[model samples]
Target: MARVVVDVMLKPEILDPQGQAVQRALPRLGFDGIAIAEVRQGKRFELEVDGPVDDAALTRIQELADTFLANTVIEDFTVKVEPS
Candidate 1:
C-alpha cells in the first residue's frame, strides 16, 4: 500500500480565527515563553492507496483537491505521495 497526503491551508490574506484563538490562548496555557508572530490553521488528509501511485492517480487526487478538498478562492493545497 501507498500513502498520499494532502495539506490545505487558507490564503495568506484570509483571517484564521481558530488559529488566532489558539495563539491568544497560548500564553495563558503556559506557553508565554514562546513568541509567535502569527498563527494559521489548516487541514491534513491522508489517503491510503492499494497500489503504486502513478501519474493518473496523482492527477485524480489533484482534481479532488481542487474540486472538493480545498476552496480555490480562499485556500491552497499540496499533495504528496509518501513512500510505502
Candidate 2:
C-alpha cells in the first residue's frame, strides 16, 4: 500500500477570513504582543492505495483536489506520497 499525505492551503496573497476571526478572538483571550495571527486553515489527508506512481493515480489525485480537497478558486495544495 502507498500512503499519501496532502496539505491543502490558501494562496499567499489571499486573505484568510478564518484566521482573522481567530486573531480577533485572541485579544479577548488575553493574547497580546503578537503581531497577527495569520491563520492558514489546511487539511492533512492520509490516502492508502495499492499501486506505484502511475499516470492514472496522478490524474485521479488531481481530480480529487479539484473535486473536493480544495476550493479551486482560492486555494492550492501540495501532496507527499510514501510507499509502505
Candidate 3:
C-alpha cells in the first residue's frame, strides 16, 4: 500500500466570499494586525491498493481524478503517489 497526497486550492482570480467574511470578522474578534486571508477547499482520501509502480496503476489514478477526485468546474489538483 502507498499514501496518495492530493491538494486542491481555489484559483486566485476566483471570488471567495467565505474567506472574505472570515477576514472581515477577524479584527472584530480581537485578532489584531491582520493582513489578508483566502479560503480554499480540498480533501485527502487514504485507500489501500496492491501494486508496484506501473503504467496500469498510474492510468487508474488519473481516471480516478477525472471521474471523482476533482471538480473540473471550479478546481484542479495534483496527486502524488508514494511508496508505503
Candidate 4:
C-alpha cells in the first residue's frame, strides 16, 4: 500500500480568519515570544492506495485535489507520496 498526503492551504492573497484569530490569541496565551508575522490554517489528508506509487496516481491525486479537496480559486494544494 502507498500513503499519499494532501495538504490544502489558502493562497497567499487570501484572508485566513481562523489562523489570524489563533495568532491574535497567541500573545494572550503567553506566547508573546513567538514572532510569527502571519498565520494560515490548512487541511491535511492521508489516503491509502493499494499499489505501488506512480506518476499516474500522483497526477490523479492532483486532479482530485483540484476538483474536490481545495477551492482552486482561493486555495492551493500539494500532493506527496510517502515512502512505504
Candidate 5:
C-alpha cells in the first residue's frame, strides 16, 4: 500500500482568523522568543491506497481535492505521494 498526502491552505490574499488567534496566543503561552512572523493554519488529508499510486490515481485524487476537500475560491491544495 501507498500513502498520499493532501495539504490544504488558505490563499495568500485571504484572512485566516484561526491562524491569527493562534499567533496572538503564542506569546501568552510562553512562546515569545520564537520570533514568528505569521501563521496560516490549514488542513491535511492522508489517503491510503491499496497498491502503487499511478498517474490516473493522482489525477483522481486531484479531482477529489478540487471538488470536495477545499474551497477553490479561498484555498489551494497540494497532493504528493508519500515515500513508502
Candidate 6:
C-alpha cells in the first residue's frame, strides 16, 4: 500500500483571519522571542491507497487534491506519495 499526503493552504493574496488570530495570540501566550512574521492555517490529508506508488496513483491523488481536497479558486495544494 501507499500513502498520499495532501497539503492545502490559502493563496498568498488571500487574507487569513484564523492565522492572524493565532499569530496575535502567540505573544500573549508567552511565546516570546519567536520571530513569526506571519501564520497561515491549512489542512493536511493522508490517504492510504491499495497499491504501489506509481505515476497513475500520483495522478489520481493530484486529481483528488485539485477537485476535493482544496478550493482551487483561493487555495493551493501539494501531493506527496510515500510508503505506508
Which candidate should be chosen as best, given lDDT against the real structure?
A: 5
Give the per-residue lDDT digits (tens) of candidate 5, residues 1-84.
999999999999999999999999999999999899999999999999997799999999999999999999999999999999
| Clash pairs for candidate 3 | none
The candidate scoring highest on TM-score is 5
| Residue range 48-76, candidate 4, lDDT tens digits | 99987789888998999999999999999
User: Worst lDDT window (10 residues) for model 5?
Assistant: 49-58
Per-residue error (Å), model 3, residue 77: 1.1
TM-score of each model, paired residue for residue: 0.95, 0.65, 0.63, 0.94, 0.97, 0.93
lDDT of 1 by residue, 24-43 (tens): 99999999897898889999
Candidate 6 local accuracy as lDDT? 0.90
At residue 63, what lDDT does model 6 achieve? 90
State the lDDT of candidate 3 residue by residue for 1-84, as single tens digits: 666666555555667676678777778998867565554445565545575746787678777876787776776767677667
Compared with the true structure, all predictions reach lDDT values of: 0.94, 0.77, 0.67, 0.93, 0.96, 0.90
Can you tell me which runs of candidate 5 are displaced by over 4 Å? none
- Give the per-residue lDDT of model 2 (tens digit) for 1-84: 788777788888888788678878887998877867466666777888776857789778878977799886888888778766
Q: Indicate whether candidate 3 or candidate 6 has the larger lDDT.
A: 6
Please list all clashing residue pairs in model 1, or write none if there are none: none
Greater lDDT among 2 and 6 belongs to 6
- For model 1, what is the C-alpha lDDT against the true structure? 0.94
Model 6 alpha-carbon drift over 4 Å, by segment: none
Q: Encode model 6's per-residue lDDT on 1-84: one tens digit a residue.
A: 768889999999999999999999998999968799999999999998886878887897899899988999999899987655
The global Cα lDDT (0 to 1) of model 4 is: 0.93
Instruction: Give model 2 RMSD, 1 decimal.
Output: 2.8
